[model samples]
Target: MKTVLIAGFNGSMGQQAVKLVNSMEGFAITAGLAHHLPDSDPTSYGLPASTQLFTSLNEIPAGIADIWLDFTVPTAVYANVKYALTHGYRPVVGTTGLTDDQEVELKKLTQDNHLGGLIASNFGMSAVLLMKFAQEAAKYFPDVEIIEMHHEDKKDAPSGTALNTAKLISKNRPAHQTAPDETESLAGSRGGDYEGIKLHAVRLPGYVAHEQVLFGGAGEALTIRQDSFDRKSFMSGVKVALEQVHTLDQLVVGLEQIL
Candidate 1:
């Protein structure tokens, strides 16, 4: 059985991971580290009684865990992942908002240590497919725009998913030389620019996670979209990373590799 330690197990996505781990065989949650627990117990989120819960990473036993599942926020993801890698523990990060420099450092650290780590902005399978589809469509399109929607509680706007999609599509863009705009329109109508692609971010209370990429050519448009209806939808991606962590000892930026 693979022993997994869940970091930030009290969060929304963390709770989902908790459910998924419990449902699977040949895997067990060794322990969980939550910044703080709810009034009741961790088992309220379906964590097994066999799983120990701690408030801080400092309390975790060294080398006991095969991997650390990070479902925490971006604000704390970097430090948590670093701690896991430094101690020879693999990490699967579902948190978004890690900076480019942080990612570079993360890959370097993982490679130097010969340890595996998986980080993805969105672990929903459709989300990965949407990214891939957008990238493919980019090869033929001249303009692209992205729209991402998430829960209001998500701190980062223009979610990592939208930005990453833009980056991917921009890489294969036509060489027609369209300058990335510097225009100020309707105050915030242009959204944020990732390379030459325009990105729009939306936050609402009822949304789980949703994104779409619109590619416009001379007279036609193609849109690829994906939605995570519930937190449980992310379980497949998490499970895939957990299943593949041993085989890949390098940092994987997305779920495309495992799929």
Candidate 2:
């Protein structure tokens, strides 16, 4: 059985991870880490009595788990993942807030330690396909813009998925201005820019997770969209990552790499 340690165990996504791990056959929840909480009793959090609970990274015992499932906040995710990598736990990260430089540094650490890990921006299969489809469409339709929507509680702007989509689109689309002389009547109205592509972020109470890629051609336009109606949609991809992460030679970014 693969023993799993879930970080951010009190958060919404973390609770979902707990359910997923419990429901899976070969995986077991060995421990949980949630720094924001004062209570360390596993039973108080509705976890199994046998599952160990920790309030901080320093308190987690080594060799307690084989996999580190992270759904922590943006501010804590980088440090959490770093600790997992160095301390012999393979990571399957879903928390998004890591900068480009931080990813580079973690990739090197994984290589040096000879550990396998994955950092996925979005685990929903539809979202992954949207990014893949967006990259392909960018070859034919270079003039494109992206809009991503999430819950109000999401911490980061221009979410990791949106940023990854932009990077993928940039690879196929040349760097050129979409509207050279266009001026906004109101300041910052056209959304954030990434290599000439406009990216708009929306956070609202009703939205789950959604994204749209709009492309304009000579006389026609194309729009590709994907939505996650429930957080459970992401668990399937997380299951795949857990089963296959140990096969990877080094840490990699994006679910597409594994897919």
Candidate 3:
């Protein structure tokens, strides 16, 4: 059985990971780590009785778990991954916000340690396909924009999926989009720009995670959309990453790599 440790165990995604892992065979949650209630008992925080819990990676004992599944906040993700690597545990990170430089350093660290590490922006299978489709579409239609919607509780803007989509689309496109030289009465009406692709983010109570990539051409416009209506949509990808991570020699970014 693959022993797993879940960081950010109290968060929605972490709790969902616990449930999914327990439902499957050949895997066990060795322990959990959270960002809150450091002085109190972790068991009281609603976890499986067999799983131990801690408030920080510093408190986790070495060799207690093989893989650390992280769904923590952006500010803490780098520290969590570094600690996991230091403690000799492979990491499957779903938390975003690590810059390109940080990823380069983490890749080197994983290579030196000969450990499998994953940093994925989105874990839904449809989302992965959506990005692939967006990349393919960008070759034909260089004018594109992204609209990403998530729950209000989500801390990050533009969602990692949108960012990844923008990056992928920008990479495959042949030329920069034609600039619209129109004046805007609103300062932020055009949305954020990344490689000339406009990105818009929306946060609402009813949304889980959704992204729509709109591509414009001469006469026709194409829209590629993916919706993650439930948190469970991400668990299958997480399981896939967990199962395949140990075989990797270095850090891999994007779930598409493993898929």
| Global lDDT of model 1 | 0.85
Tell me, by TM-score, which candidate is best.
2
RMSD of 2: 1.3
Candidate achieving higher TM-score, 2 or 3: 2
Tens digits of per-residue lDDT, candidate 2, 1-259, equal 9999999889888888888888889888989998777776787766778998888899998899999999999999999999999999999999999998999999999999899999999999999999999999998899999999999999998998999999999999865545787778998889998888899999999999999999998899999999999999999999999999989889989998998
Cα RMSD to the true fold for all candidates: 1.8, 1.3, 1.7
Q: What tens digits encode model 1's per-residue C-alpha lDDT throughout 1-259?
A: 8899998778888888888888889999878888877643656767877678887778877777798999887788889998898888899999888998999999999988899889988888999999888888888885878899999999888898888888888788876457554667568878876766778999999999999888777878887889888988889889999999889879999888778
Candidate 2 residue 220 C-alpha distance from true site, Å = 0.4
Tens digits of lDDT, candidate 3, 57-107 = 668999999999999998999999988887889999999888788889888
| Residue range with the least summed lDDT across 10 consecutive positions in model 1 | 176-185
Backbone clash tally for model 2? 0
lDDT of each: 0.85, 0.92, 0.88
Ranking by TM-score: 2, 3, 1
- Cα RMSD for predicted model 3: 1.7
Candidate 3: lDDT over CA atoms?
0.88
User: Candidate 3, clashing residue pairs?
Assistant: none
